[model samples]
Target: MGTKWITFDLDETIMQNPFGKWVFPEIVNMLKKEADTEEDILDLIVSEHLQRMSEERFLEAYDWDDIITDVAEKLGAVSAIDIERMVIKHSEPPKIYLLEDNMLDYLEQIKEKGFHLAAATNGYSKYQLPVLQKLGLDKVFDEVITSDSAGFAKPNPAVLKKLSDEGEIAAHVGDRIDHDVLLANRLGILSVFVHRSLPAEVLSLPVDKRAEQPSCIRLCEEKWHKENRLREVPFMENECIPKVVVQSIGELAESIDFIIK
Candidate 1:
């Protein structure tokens, strides 16, 4: 395989939220308790920004003031200033997917093989760095670049390219076809898709093949679960794409064995 560089995405690829979670909207809805309509509106404003951060090229241009003011008007607060309380509430984490056990060890194995390990995350240093440190990846990854740092996010290959060493053949491993695998394809790097939580039936075949089956969409309804709550998986999203897929970083470690060794 001759793979020399390996980059990763943070949110779902490495670890997920403490719970199988929805990001901005779900958190905003939760924190919008009856303190005041102003408080709720403020939460909505923050949620709007976080949603934009994940979905768009937020670093290139963002009108935070406009987002806040518009949200204030929609919530009948009249002024964005009216929503601001003196006592200060910090912004909640945009996403806080906890690291799973041994995900780091897998990377360590990759590192031992002498690959230049790096991270290309949608999240910034303030949030992403701490998680890496907690997972003991603070020193493991040669570079930890982010959307805020790079001015672009996933599905956009620019971040990956910018963070790449420029001399090495690369592979990127992450959990999303929309973001990670797509980035790999666009950048002409090897793509390794990870699907840890899927049921055995849907995972009976590689994702690219399984995704083509009519049974794929149906399986999402029956098998995708966390905390005993079933939710529809975006199975169709994986279709006939990302020639490589694995369920865990340990699997990732194995897939890279030939190349790394």
Candidate 2:
């Protein structure tokens, strides 16, 4: 496959969470004073997040403000929203933009080789586009396809195919094996898996043990679509053992070269 275009996953593939650096640390520190321990607060938060991830209702859109405030109120801790507002008001604080390590140079390197770059991700366009702007990577990708535009998320062929032109050879690079690799395998396109966040811990467990409740997700989505439904969408049923896995974005570039040849 002589790949003409390479599409990438946004979060943790080449983009990270912007607020985690300052916002979360402050919340944690605040919680630590009131909670039994830092670890306990952390565990609470993680548990809530995992619960949300497993719940089909809250799976798609993450409400961080709600999560922080609710967690704060529950734990009898200082309001994270208040602390965040104060932090923003008081001083000219440091701003940390989200981008994966070595992502820029690698993208540039590929572009120099005349490869068309794009992004196909499972997110709302409103939120995801701003993230790309903040990272100054808005222009890096030739095109960006989101769930909003695609009418569905990855593992559904439509999202990736949104970045394609007729007869164009393409490869998708992402961290999630099920979302990215399995989707590519199904479409018979080149798949490159980047090991970033979300360790494949979900994979080691049996289907019943996994966190993703796809049936619930589909039901919720179906309801959502029915009220605002356009057409039918697919669901995540099974996982295929991924064939192309890499440790970093830099490695992805190498893999792209190897696969294309």
Candidate 3:
């Protein structure tokens, strides 16, 4: 067989953008005047997005413009110009941080072992590309495939099929059990789950402070459940179960070797 490929999920797997997922909340705050309450607007935005995802299996089915425009029309409050401006302002490149120390070094070491590496993520190139550049990982991957580029998302075997076309995929690493593990299991590839536990400082932050920085609340909540050994989703089926699990990316190389044996 040709050189095997090792794929990774970008967002919570390789890096953490503390504020990336909180963009919608920030938008609700900006348009507070247009809606009756911030909570109402936020609920509408999230519900509408979820509805779209349900109908269109692709994660990138509807862009922000479509969702925001629909929300505005329902409320009949915000203007087109204001919505456009808010989207632009909040869409700036987010400050990204590596989830683990020596992330780049670890990836390079894996590459040197003769395996081709690829980043198979469920995101648009416009956002994911800048993240790789910021983390100095732009040169590490032989291929960087996003949902927008692949025209498909995780848990769908088609995304991995594209990567497999270049070379056989030996394994896939990601933080999500549902999306990442499920996708790998379906394709008969080794699935590695990297558990991202937040630092004590982040977990102990005041509730008010967490609210000030939107993603903190989510980070803290997830960490709490993990620390307590609780599962957010009650049951895990065979497809969703990862073949191997590690605490951090620093241990990823060893896990990959374990799978190879």
Return the number of clashes found in candidate 3. 0
Clash pairs (backbone) in predicted model 1: 16-97, 17-97
lDDT of 2 by residue, 209-252 (tens): 23243433343234333422222334333334344555567755
lDDT of 1 at 174: 78
What tens-digit string does per-residue lDDT give for candidate 1 at 1-261? 333678887777775432123333433343344224645554566566656654453553234445655664565544323112210122223444335567778888888877888887766555455556655667778888887777777767677665554656468887766567667877877777676765576578754465444455443323323211322334334431565666778866766765333
RMSD of each: 7.2, 10.2, 8.7
TM-score of 3: 0.73
Native RMSD of candidate 2 (Å): 10.2
| Model 1 quality (TM-score) | 0.64
Worst ten in a row by lDDT for model 2? 223-232
Cα deviation at 42, candidate 3, in Å, is 3.1
**Higher-lDDT candidate among 1 and 3?**
3
* Candidate maximizing lDDT: 3
In model 1, where do residues sit more than 4 Å from their true spots? 1-3, 16-35, 38-55, 58-98, 201-240, 258-261
Error of 1 at 195 (Å): 1.2
